[model samples]
Structure formats: structure tokens, C-alpha cells
Target: MGFLPNSMLIMARKPGLVEAFAGLGLAVQGPSALPDEIKRMAAFMASRAAGCVYCQTHTHHQAANAGISADKLEALWDYETSDLFSEAERSALRVAQSAAQVPNAVTGADMSALKQHFSDEQIVDLVAVISLFGFLNRWNDTFATALEEEPSAHAAAHMAAHGWDAGKHAR
Candidate 1:
């Protein structure tokens, strides 16, 4: 049987809040100087760093749809030393990881490095991707949201080797 994720259903309990959250997420995912692949990758990295299974699975699925390779997704945790990522992708991933840390570990050096590779507007988009996933990661984790089937399967097939598990978010 099909099911709505608990996170969305719970948010739906407050229609206005759900609508507002969805609106803001759409805005963040809208067209930008930053490529969709980069935004998706950044979001995935943020979700992984946040340790939210539901968000991680969802972002991983989206990242694949945005043209990120299975190899890249599998190796994302090591992007800092991976040859698959470009300098710009590495910079963006670093920003995602730092920003997603608890207590907000992002530093000036992180932003400076990002600036070397991205325009100010692009940096904004990267931050927006991280911020969007940050909200989703907290919401899904708090709700123990059940993973949707597609993302669940995708994560199983592609993310398991990277230490991904459904955990409390299992469907």
C-alpha cells in the first residue's frame, strides 16, 4: 500500500505551516546560478551530516535525478579527498558539511574558499540548499518519518555501502 511520510502528514496537520514550508523549499530549489546538481549534492551532504535517514535518502534520490553519479554519491563523504569532485563541488560540499554541523561550525575560511569558486549569488544558493535540508533533516528526524519506497530502495542499493540505514525512519 502507498503511504504519505509521517513528516509530511504531521506537517499537514498544520496546513498553513506545511504550505509555508513547502513554498520556501520550492523557492530554494528554484532556478539559480548554481547548477541543480550542485544544489542537490550540497543538500545531500547536509542531510548526511545531520544524520537524518529520511532526508539523506530523499536528497540522495534527488541528487541522482539531478545527474550526480552513483559513484559520486557513494563517495561523497570523502569528497575532500576524492578525485571525482571538482574544486567547486568540493568547496560547496565543505560549506554544506560545516553548516550542517551542530553548533554551526561554519568558519570564515570555509566561506572564503567557497568564494574562490562561486559568485556571491551562487554562494547564496549553496547556503539555501544546506538550509533547506537542515530544516528537512530536523523535521524528519524529530518525526521519525517513514522512508518512502523509492528513496528507501535507492538508499538500500546505492547508499548502504556508505553506512546509510533507515534507522528510526524505516518505512
Candidate 2:
């Protein structure tokens, strides 16, 4: 048997659910204090480490739109050995990987890198983005939510049509 009945699933797909997703989208997109590329990179690294295919796809396209190269994206699979990443990207990935594996595994080196590269405010937002996606990864994994479509496309269209900070949108 599946996790939930079809009727309940349908109810979960109602307008209120859509609104909640919209809120999350806005929250992720509303980090005006941080560069959009860095935020997307952080989210992508966290999602990759968490093994959330949905988020991986979403953040991959988001990275692409933010001017990340395909080679760099592919190198994310083995970021440690790849030359495609910058010091900042590598540092953030270290944080995400350590956070994913063991909470305190993010060491002094990681902290130093973060401090060197990102502002305090940006670090706060970065951590929040990581934490949020960690939660999302678990939730989506638990529910076995099939990532059938790329959310980045949806987000792009929404931003293009309405603007980046638009009030409401879909998942």
C-alpha cells in the first residue's frame, strides 16, 4: 500500500497547499541580501548532499540560469577533485557535505572559508537555505515524492512573467 489514500492526496493538492508552496518559493527567492547565485549554489549543494532529486533538478537549472557552467554542475558529483569550482563554491560544498553527513563535521577550515568568502548576513542566509532544504529533502524523501518536473523552469517562468519578488506562484 502507498503512504496515503488518493482522496487525501488530492486534498493535499488543494489551493492551500499551493499557497504554502508559493510561500516557500518566495522565501527562497526573497534573499535579496545575498547574491542570487550564491544562494542557489548553497541550496544546490545541500540538495545534492541530501540526495533529493527534486531539489537537485530544481537547483541545477537555477544554477544554469545564474550562469553556472554545465561542466561545473557535472563536477558537483565529485566536487572535491574537480577544478570547475571556485574557492567559495568548494567552501560552501564543504559545509553542506559536512552538515549532511554529521552536524559538527563542518570544521574550523569550513568556518574560516565561509568567513573569508561570505559576509555574516550572507552566512546566516546560507545556513538558513541549507537548513530549509535539509528539511525539504527529508520530507520529500519520506513521502516518496516523484520529481517529475524541473521546478526551476516553473520558477523562471514565474519570474519572467511576474518579476522576481512576485507575491504568489506555483511549485
Candidate 3:
């Protein structure tokens, strides 16, 4: 990595915390049966729902790298009504949004809908992606981590039209 994120630098003050957090993050995001695009999309949506500008921009960049179309990414907040997403994608995004809510609003119907399209393992992966972003959302928001340049530029070019703002999180 050229420059470590501010969040990673802060976590580095406690090496064990950095190791454990990075390990879990790698494990959750590394090779898996779950398609990378879906995982990235879920992570992106979770970050959006959490209102973490740092994470939303980071995941949006990652999702673009993973080949998620700008159309799909832009339409994500309207996933339920958009034809850009498959039923499976919609289900997974719904799970991510619901689970990312402050009170953990995920419902049985959400799980049921997910089961209609994804295996238990895939469901676990979805939850893992959402849960990872939950940690990241809180970490970034609480630390007020400065937005890295690349993500900042990407957000301005691609996300500002969607109402994303750097706000207090801007470097």
C-alpha cells in the first residue's frame, strides 16, 4: 500500500488490534464462493446505509474496480425498484441495508428472501461483508479519518451526484 489509511494508522497504535482486524477483513473479503461483485456491492450498500462517507467512497471505488457498472452503482439506493439489478442482487442489497441500520433492523422476511436466491454459505458471506462494513463504518466515523485522495476524487466525480458529501470527513 502506498499510504496506509488513517484508520489503519490509528489501529496500528495497537498492533494486535491491527493484526486481528486486518486478518478478519482479509478473510471476509478474500477468495470465496460469493461473487466479488456482489460482495463489493453489498459492502458498498452497507456503507451507504451507515452514512460513512469514507467507507461509501472506498467501497464505491472497490466496486468499480470489481467491474460493477456505474449504472448499477448509481442505482443502488433504488435497488428495490431498479431493473439494473437481478433479484439475487436486490435481495442481498436489501439484507445489507437492513442489517446495517442502527438497531439492526434485519427481519425474517429478509432472510427468507435471501434464502430464495443464495445458499447458506453465500448468506454468511453477505453477512460477513455487511458486518465488516459495520466495523469500518463505526471506526471511520468515530476517528474522523481523513479521506484518502483517490477515494475523495472518485467520490466527487461519481458519487456527489448521488448526494454523497465529504463533510467533516474530508481531509
Q: Against the true structure, whose lDDT is highest?
A: 3
Worst 10-residue lDDT window for candidate 2 reads 162-171
**Candidate 3, which segments miss by more than 4 Å at Cα?**
1-3
Better of 2 and 3 by lDDT: 3
List, residue by residue over 1-171, the lDDT tens digit for candidate 2: 112322235336687975675587577668567777667777877876786655655666667767876667566767777887778777878887777654447888898998898888877877777887787667665565543334545434432332222122123
RMSD of 3: 1.2
Which candidate comes out best when scored by TM-score?
3
- CA RMSD per model (angstroms): 2.1, 9.8, 1.2
lDDT of each: 0.87, 0.65, 0.90
Q: Residue-pair clashes per candidate, as listed?
A: 0, 0, 0
Candidate 1, residues 93-151: lDDT per residue as tens digits?
88898899998988999988899999999999999989888888988898898888888
Candidate 3's residue-wise lDDT over 21-48, tens digit each? Answer: 9999999999988889999999988998
Q: Between candidates 1 and 2, which one is better according to TM-score? A: 1
lDDT of 3: 0.90
Please list all clashing residue pairs in model 1, or write none if there are none. none
Error of 2 at 52 (Å): 1.9
Error of 3 at 171 (Å): 0.8
